[model samples]
Target: MNDTNSLEPVTAAAVYRAYNGGYFKTLVSPEQTGGSFALLEMVLPQGAEPPAHLHEKEDETFYVLDGTVSFRIGSKTYIAGPGETIFAPRLIAHEFRITSSQLHFITLLTPGSFWDYFMEFSTAADAVPVVKAPTELPPADFLMHLINRLNSQYGVKLV
Candidate 1:
C-alpha cells in the first residue's frame, strides 16, 4: 500500500530514488498527499557535499542513517554520526558535507511540499550543463529562479 493509508508498516525498501544527483530518494512528499511534510533519504558518497542553502518558509530536520556527516547550520558546524539528528529552523542558513567514507541519512521537512521544490532543484541540477566547484555557489539569479519556480509550483515561497 502507498504511504497515505493502509495498516502495513512502510518499509524503507519502498523509498524511491530521487532525480536530483541520483543520491537521494523519497518516501513521501506533498505529491503523496496535501500533507504539509516530506521525508527524504540522502546518500552521500565520500567527499560529497550539498551546496549551502537555507529555507525561508520551511524547517528542515536531519537524522543520520550511517557514517559521519559535517552539518553546518548557520555559523556553527558539527560532525553528526549515525543515530544523530539536526534541525534547522526556517530562515536559517545550512549546508552539509559527507566527512566519513560514506554517509546516509533521512531528512524531513516540516511541510511536505518542500520536497517538491527540492525535487525540482535536483532535477534542474541533473539537467544543467555547467559544473559547480565544490566551494562555489550558484549565481544569485539562478538561485532566485529556482526558488521562484518552486514557489509557483509547490506553493512554498523561498523568499
Candidate 2:
C-alpha cells in the first residue's frame, strides 16, 4: 500500500471536456486513495444528460454545488439544488440532467472506476463537443459501440 497521507491538489487546468458538454476534473483518484474511491467535480450545461446506466462494481454519490439538477434512480426521480446530495448504489440504473442553465457538482465513486471511463470517453476522437441540447445529436453507432466497450472494461452497464 502506498502512503495515502501525501497531499496534492488538482487544478482547473486539468479539467476534461466530456462529450455531453460537461467539464470533469478528477480531484482524488483511486491511486491517491489506495483504490478506495475517486472524487470528481463536474460542470454540466442545461439539457445535458448521460444515458441511464449502472455500475456493477461501484457506488456513486453526487453533491450539488450550484444550479439545479434532476436525477432518475431506478423508478424514482428527484430534483436537487445547491448543497444537496444524492447517492446511487451499485447495480441500480441511474442518470442525471442539468435542469438549470448550468450545474456544478462533486461526485464520489467507491471502489473507484468511473474516472477511467470518463477519461476514455472524453478523449475518444469521435467524441463531439456538445454545446447545446443533446436531443438533436445524430445517432452514432460506432460511438455507441466504443462507449459500450469502454463501459464493459470499466464495469459500467449502459441501459
Candidate 3:
C-alpha cells in the first residue's frame, strides 16, 4: 500500500495531514485500480469542514467509522453516525462537518482521478501524525487564493 500503491492483500496507506489537523489517506488509488476509483480514509476533528462544493467528474460515497457528521448533499440535509453512509454525486453541491467530537470515515470516489486533488497536499508518510494542529484556516487572503487555484483546475466549484 505504501510503496506499491496496492491493496490486494492490505497494507498501511501514505498519509496527508492538512495544516488544520484533518487527515486523508488513500487506501486504494486510481492508478492502482486502473482508473476505476479511489478509496480514502479521513480523520477530521470538529469544525474542520470545507464550504459547500461539487465535483464535475466524480461522485463520492462516504461510510462513517466513528463519531458523527452533519451533511448537506444537494437538496437533502441529514446527519450520519457510525455505520451510516452518504452519497454525493457529481455536480451536486455537498459539504459535511464533523458534528461530534471528531469523525473518522471512508469515502469512495468513483470513475477517475479526483484523488489527484488530495495528492497535491499529501506527503508519503514516514509516520502518521497524532498531535492536533491549529483548526483555523490559513489567513483568509491566502486561503481564498489557494482555494481558487485548486477549484479551477479540479473542476470543482465552491457553492
Candidate 4:
C-alpha cells in the first residue's frame, strides 16, 4: 500500500457529462488514491435506467447523499434514500434507476482501474445542473445491445 502521507484533500471536483445528460464529479481519482479506489459524486436525473451489468474487475458501493435510487442486485431490489448505502460486489449483476426528481450520490469503486469506464463513457463538462430534467433514453432493445457492446470493452458484462 502507498504511504498515507501521499494522499491529499480534494477541495474541488471536475464535472463530467454522461450520455443520459446527468453529471459525474470525480472526487478522488485512481492516481490520487494510489490505484486502490476512485471516488465520484453522481447527479442523476429521474427515470435514468442504467443497464443491468456486472463488473469483472472491481466492486462498487453507492452512498446516497440526497433523493432516492432503486437498485436491483441479483434477484433482490432495494430503495436507498439519503444516508443509505448499497454495495455491488464484482461479478454481481446489478442495475439502478434514479427514483426521485434527481438523485445525488457518492460512488466508490475498488481497485480503481474500473474507473476507466466513466472516463471512457463521460466527458468533461461545464457544470452539474441543479434541476435535473429527465432525458429520453434509447429504446430498451437498442440500449441493451449498446450497453453490452460498450461495457464489454471495460470488463463489464451486460447481465
Candidate 5:
C-alpha cells in the first residue's frame, strides 16, 4: 500500500494525449493511492467520445470542470455542464462525448487499476492536435484485441 498523505501537484508535462485530440492528466494514480482509486483530468475537443464500455470492478465518477458534455449511462442520458458531476457504477455500460467546443472533466475510478487503460492506449503522436470521427478511427478488431487484453489485466470490459 502507498501513502496518501502527501500532496500531489498537477504538472503540465505530465499530460497524456489520447489518439483523438483529448488530453489526460493523472492526478492520483493507483500506486499513489494504495490501489484505492485513481483520479484523472481530461480535456476533450468537440466530437470527442469514447466507445461505450464498462468496468467490471471499478466504479467511476466524473466531475465536469469546463464546457458541456453528453453522457450515456446505461439507458439514461445526461447533459452536464461545468461544475456538475456524474457517477457510473461498476458493471454499467457508459460513454461520454464533448458537446461543446472543448470539455474538461475529472474522472475518478475506484480500485485504481483502470488508470492503466488510459496510459496503455495513449501515444506521443496523440499530442498533435487531431480529432477524427468514429468512422475514421482505427480498426475495431485491433482495438478490441487490446481492450480484451486490458480487461484480462485490469478488469475493464469494452462492451
Candidate 6:
C-alpha cells in the first residue's frame, strides 16, 4: 500500500471564505483524518488581517507562496515575501496583513484540530462584517472571541 494514499487532498476552491477578514481554503483538514496536521491556502487582500493573537499550544508555520505580507511573529515585525517562511512557536503572539493587494500563502497548523475550530467559530458565530472590500479592522471583542476559543479549546493563547 502506498503511504500517500492514506492522505486526502483539500482543494483550495472548496473551503469557505473568511468572514469580514480575507479568503482561505483548507488544503487539508481533520475531516480527512490526515494526521495531526492541517494546511490552508490563503489570499489576503490589502488591509486585511486576523488581529494580534497567539497560539500557545499549537505551532504554526507560514510559507509565502506569492506577493508580500507584513507579518508579526512575536515581538518582531517584518515583511515576508515569496519563498519566505515564518515559524511561530507555541505561546507566541502573532498576526499578519497583506500589505499588497495580492498576497497569497500556505499555512500549516500542527494538530489539525485548529482547522475544525476555525470552521466552527468562523461560520457559527463571528462578529466581523464580511465586507467585500478592504476596510477597517474588526473590533477587539471580535478577535477576542476567536483568540479565546483557540486558546481554550486548542490550548492556543493570544497574548
How do all models score by TM-score?
0.64, 0.78, 0.82, 0.78, 0.77, 0.70
Model 2, position 61, has a per-residue lDDT of: 94
Expressed as tens digits, the lDDT of each residue in 98-159 for candidate 3 is 77777889989897587887777555544664535355566898787758766887788889
lDDT of 6 by residue, 24-123 (tens): 6678886676668889887666665666777655788899998898878878997899999988776788888777776778888886777777576554
Q: Using TM-score as the measure, which candidate wins?
A: 3
Error of 6 at 115 (Å): 0.6
Candidate with more favorable, higher lDDT: 1 or 2: 2
Candidate 1, residue 89: Cα displacement in angstroms equals: 1.0
Model 2, span 1-159: residue lDDT tens: 336897576443455556566667678988998889999887778877768988889999999999898899999999999999999999999998788988889999898766777776664322323445455654698668767675768777789
lDDT of each structure?
0.67, 0.78, 0.79, 0.79, 0.79, 0.71
**RMSD to native for every prediction?**
6.9, 5.5, 4.4, 5.5, 5.2, 6.2
Runs in model 4 with CA error above 4 Å?
Answer: 1-19, 130-135, 138-151
Q: Considering summed lDDT, which 10 consecutive residues are worst modelled in model 4?
A: 8-17
Q: Going through the candidates in order, what is the number of backbone clashes in each?
A: 5, 0, 0, 0, 0, 5
Screening candidate 3 with a backbone cut-off below 3 angstroms (N, C-alpha, C), the clashing residue pairs are none
The worst-scoring run of ten residues by lDDT in candidate 3 lies at 10-19
How accurate locally is residue 95 in candidate 4, as Cα lDDT from 0 to 100? 97
TM-score-wise, the better of 1 and 4 is 4
Q: Flag the better candidate by lDDT, 2 or 5.
A: 5
Off by over 4 Å in 6: 1-14, 33-35, 123-131, 136-148
User: Higher lDDT: candidate 3 or 4?
Assistant: 4
Show the colliding residue pairs in model 2.
none
The most accurate candidate by lDDT is 4
> What overall lDDT, based on C-alpha atoms, would model 2 receive against the true structure?
0.78
Clashing pairs in 6: 20-130, 36-112, 56-91, 56-157, 151-156
